[model samples]
Target: MKRRDILKLAALAGASAVVPGVLSEVRAGPIGHTGPYWITIQAGWGWDPTLFCDPKGAPVNATYDKAQIAKAGNIPYAPSNENDAFFGKYASRLCVVNGIELSTHQIEAAFRQMWTGALEPGYPSLAALLAAGLGGGAPMPLISAGGFEETAGLVPRTRLVGAQPLDWASLTAPSADMASLFSPMTETRIAQYRRERLKAKLATSLPPGIKSVIEAAEAAELSRPKLEQWKAHWPSPLSDDPSRALIQLTLAAFKAKLSVSANLWWMLDPAVTDAAQVENFNDWTARFDVLMDEIEAFGLDNSVILVASSGGGRTPMYLDEQMKGHWSVGSMLLLGPGIPGNRIIGGTDENLRGLPLDPSTLEPNPTGVRLRPAHIHRALRRLAGIEASAEAKAFPLDAEDLPLFS
Candidate 1:
């Protein structure tokens, strides 16, 4: 495998790749129809819950003072100038999670803990563990686009830093050129001959374990139709809206069954990377509207696990009218299978301190456990219907599974 490519196949007990003449055996789950795709959209810099999920009006955060707080079913959301449309249209499918406290207030430590539920390395990302468990035989089990999508080696994952159409082309061919993978084959018989020759050699010279690799490559070479279909469905990546461009790629990977799941981080224009900038939220608002629109248009709302979360929340105590420092408590949203519509779980005070809750009832309790990202993730695993899998068991959440989804 190439250095950047992640391919960790389970080695057969007795199969030896080192021996030139000995045949190696291998086993992998078979691929079939898959749905309820899992996705995690990490906004990177935390969002201010006071302006949204953990709604704290005025005195606490003045930015959303006049922005009417809208309630869709049971979910209360601040109808900010930009994101009102989403709340009005899809709040019925949303489950807002608030009062999430991170492990620390320091930048890097908090960022790591928010996603991986740990302050240091060695903890597998929830995305990685879930992908491997649900991934039957997807060529790419996990696809991580944009920011910090560390795999920690639980399964194969692909990271797309920027535009590189040829990267998709390289799936089947040795060269990173689209033409090489999908060019017309006028001499079909010659190709058949080569394949038959390889098949014949497979019984003798080629190790059995290597056969699947060769076959998969050939399968990908014939995937030009799927590529063309994606081209018709996605928008131009070089457009003004970078989020659509990135989301288009992510959606294609999932729809094409190229991967069992994908974790997409939205990297705003360098100028708008700061979540503290109110204007950035406007950009995000518009893009998020388009995101939900496309998801509904593509008919993925019921068949995909759409999650939105961040490192932490920006403090309500603003440095100025525009900038706010990081706060320990953050927010999360879950929308997909088994997640009831318009249910808001947990809460924070006007100052954004998490309230303790009855673990079983998920109601406020004076002396109960506080919520965190790990607790949410543990519930997420159960929602995906794979909490008991060995891959999931490998990364045990220290606390008992949170019953948020139920």
Candidate 2:
């Protein structure tokens, strides 16, 4: 098989293994992830950095003056009074990466590029890479509450959100009503017989394509038991807010050892055009703080790497519509155990254009490279210790490795 075909088959097998109805007699307990947990929060509809982290004055951002920029440690944030609480509380743990240059300003392409590190379609998302590599035997692996769900068929994406309760029993059960179905022991025996027949059938010579499908079926049978363990960790009453619901689900999964990475979406009010827009962003950050608080409460703070990135950025200069247009430059915030805190890496000029940086020192250099999503993904793979994994290799982000998390 060609390399791409092999990858596709492997991805297909992985995707198949997560299906809810795989039948097996073995009762394997839930597998937990003891390593670093990754959580990526993507801010939808383009976010304006000048309204939050990267501050400007007068013509750039008419709302805030350059002199009004607030300092929290080494990082300087927007002048919005509400931002003080967020920056002040988490600045010590936050590694702000500014001036990320996106190749395209189109929303769909920007979202794909920002999270997957590939401008073209078909690459697995960063969350997928983390799950495929570091997730180990996590049943759900990567729980994508919202935003990019592209997995390149590498792994299955599960959406466990909101106050709704999951019907775990129904997923694996033989029938809707137990009274009308075969007994549990009898059903288990029937499943075991079916698996044995499939195994015997696979023992005979077969075409590569058919053989791969059978192998995937066998893998799914082996993985069926893990799904039963999720019920113990499901939250009692989930939050109504989509973002908060994602956080709660991810944390519970982390605690249950059911997941490794999660992708979350930040849906800000796109209608707000004035100063309240800044507050809207500020309020979201405050909610982000609550995520950290709960992580700490669960004693998983040290093991979690938190990321909040924008799909794209709004222009520094206002357009004729009295609102900022899409800009090529973007920003990201990383926090957790290994990342250097209270530091700002990369930057932009007054016009919100990305600056070239010396990859080695991460300092501005006239003859250096501008930061891009690929560079960030490369660093992230290193952080997750998955740079050399087959999944990462399948979807390479050919960029110089900077010490982003060190």
Candidate 3:
């Protein structure tokens, strides 16, 4: 028999000895429930909030109505008015917060399609959120589509709310060892591998520099005296394709009850090579819509929360010559369990200045001003069942924000 066949036998023998107990352990306990899942999308660049949710013609709106509109043409697009109609489908389980202000630099691009009511297809924010909230046990996993410099910081924020961060690449492409060893293939390979013990021994040496905790865990499993036991504990089979492997890994993580949150950030900054074009925003949004449908297919809607937001607004660099140095606020949409959906929460000035409106009332704050990102974060954490006292002492904004939580 081939060396592969020999190792397979040894692995199978080891697994048969442990499979029943391990399987029982998995099924015996109650799956830990970590409240709801929450997600926040940061439109890195300035996202024009006005295009999606505008204030009912206040001073800022008046100025834009008289000058900016004539210059920019029908400031609000067709989709802005349909917030209630579209989100209402998931009303009791969703909350749409508009007029969120993000402090960031603006590169040159005019007209904000990033958050202009049109969806970019295949964006993963909503899908990931839904998966986590509905998945039991550990906090929902957050997955990001595009890499970001601030991901480390953003991840901890979710953790504070009791959700875990699902590594995007790993989810898409699970480790080969995790699959080959634990899958049913192990049973088939058991008798074959035992006949070639020498080859199996030679192949088992781990490579250098593999020090991750997960790697260590795998190494420990591989060292088991009974190969069958180790095989039974290995992860399920994985695909050779990286992307397909990731999806499988994500599903496995969910099935294993290991993660509850995932996030995918689609680059919207014009400065980035991969930024979506204005004409393609609709197509992109549609892709995201389809992705959500796929998540629903997983039957995780009841426990998950879907959130969509822009890194920031963009100004089309190809547009009008005179328009320069202007920035727009980003937009956010929420849909999921326990959310109050089918409603727009805040308003924006025609110039995209976010107004300070009560989240419940949707009326302007008499105190005068706009809502800040910090407040938005506070509200979201609340939705996730993270008490204000549990928030990190380190404030994303001013140290004063700590007081708000206290």
How close is each model in CA RMSD to the real structure? 8.8, 7.9, 12.2
Task: For candidate 3, write residues 110-182 as lDDT tens digits.
Answer: 1122321112222222223233234322322333333331222222112111122222222112233355557
Best candidate per TM-score, number? Answer: 2
Model 2 lDDT-worst window of ten:
9-18
Best-to-worst TM-score order: 2, 1, 3
**Local lDDT at 166 for model 1:** 29
Clashes of 1: 0
lDDT of each: 0.63, 0.73, 0.38
The regions of model 3 sitting more than 4 angstroms off are 1-35, 39-47, 50-94, 106-142, 149-252, 267-278, 314-328, 358-362, 388-391, 394-406
Structural similarity to truth (TM-score) of each candidate? 0.75, 0.83, 0.52
Give per-residue CA lDDT, model 2, range 264-331, as digits (tens).
77654673364656756876777787788778766887899988887778876666767666777889
Give lDDT for model 3: 0.38
Any idea how many clashes model 3 has? 73
